[model samples]
Target: MLDPILLWSGLVNGLLQGAIYALVALGLTLIYGVLHIINFAHGSLLMLAMYGVFLLFSQFGIDPYAALPIMVVGMFVLGYGLQRGLISRASHGRDENILLVTLGISIVIENLALFFFQGDTRTIDVPYAFDSLEVFGVFIAIPRLIAFAAALLIAGLLWLMIQRSDVGRAIRAVAKEKQGARLVGINVEHIYAVSYGVGIACLGAAACLLMPTYLVYPTVGHAFVLIAFTVVVLGGMGSFPGALLGGLLIGLCESFGGLFLGESFGQIGIFLVFIVVLLFRPSGLLGSRV
Candidate 1:
């Protein structure tokens, strides 16, 4: 029989970890839903945000939490420009071209970091870095708990914006039918840019949230981007809530699987779940069929 305390600890840890994954995956799903493009560079944007947080903290002594707004604004502008300047043009071409373009962007960002920052691993020193809260006999890291709360709050706000706001309506319209949205007088290109900006904004928030617990490195995004893709697919490509569910599920699988099987086997468990989900429900748990 499994140790109850260990199981509880794993569950708590997994939920917190999954919350961050959900934030990242939600961004990817939003972009894919509207633009029909998989942003291979999403993780690179996240890496940039991590570096941004690091710089702000190291140079000006700004706290990562306090620096979040600036990071979000900066990343949003960068994402918007990137969409308008480069991605927009490439998007008109074949899917293969779009994939190649995003992949190229990722490579550029990674190499740029390597050139400037080298391959060193860096992390931020924060007050809550090692603090934990015990709840019902389970100890949860404070930083991860904060991240979990932030993730849920952001997800809720995004869901509300998509469902209730005018811009959200336009975004949804475009995602549903691009030509129809255009015929209805919506500036499709601008909406596309805004959508991409929103996606990157999520990454910015995630970067700050993760900095206290994780290290920043040139190749850090490679692992996250893969996990984000897996979450996006498992959650159902365009489904918002589905991403959250998928993230938590993957988090639990990883934590428990690692405890029982081994650290390396945890990823195997995630892939196994992915394969099962694909075979049974290709549309994802919440995604609707066209």
Candidate 2:
């Protein structure tokens, strides 16, 4: 039988990891909800943000946590410009076209990272990297705890923004009915850009949270693309609540799977869950059928 302490530890770690996954998914779901674009570039954008964190830390001696606002604002601007100048114009308001454009953007980003940073994996050496907190004999990394808290806080803030802000209302209007939103004096295109910017901004926060423990590389985004998509689909394409729940569930699956099945086969659980959800509950746990 598995030790209860080890099991609890795995569960806690999974929950922490899942929170970050959900954070990544939030941006993706938001973009899909508002702009109706798959954003194939989402993972690439995340990798870019991670690189930004790496550069800021290595070159300027800035702490990853301290770089949070910088990365968020910088990514938001990048996202806004991409949507306004490139995606919006290049896509011609077609989903397939947008998909291609985003894929192209992903390719470009990966190549740019390769050209600039090379393909070697990079990691930061923060003082607290080796620190941990023990609770009832289950030890948790301090970084993991901080990440968990930040992820939830950011998710809560995002929910509030969507629910209470004027710009958020315009975003919702555009998401529901672009023509109607335009008729009401809401700038549909600008809302699209803003929504895209906010989505990418989530990645900035995620990068900051992940950098203390995770390594970065030109193709690091690939590690997350499948999992992020799984979270989004398992939660429902456009449901933020679904994303949050799905992330936690997937995280648990990963932790327990790794514990029992060993590293080689551990990922089987995530795939299994994805397959089951697709077969039985394509709308996701909290999402409404489209």
List the candidates' TM-scores in order.
Answer: 0.97, 0.98
Count residue pairs with overlapping backbones in model 1.
0
lDDT of 2 at 192: 93
RMSD of candidate 1 to the truth, in angstroms, is: 1.1
**Global lDDT scores for all candidate models:** 0.91, 0.93
| C-alpha lDDT of candidate 1 relative to the true structure | 0.91
Deviation in Å, model 1, residue 146 alpha carbon = 0.2
Screening candidate 2 with a backbone cut-off below 3 angstroms (N, C-alpha, C), the clashing residue pairs are none
Screening candidate 1 with a backbone cut-off below 3 angstroms (N, C-alpha, C), the clashing residue pairs are: none
Candidate 2: tens digits of C-alpha lDDT, residues 51-167: 999999999999999999999999999999999999999989989999999999999999999999898999999999979988989988999899999999999999999989999
Most TM-score-accurate candidate: 2
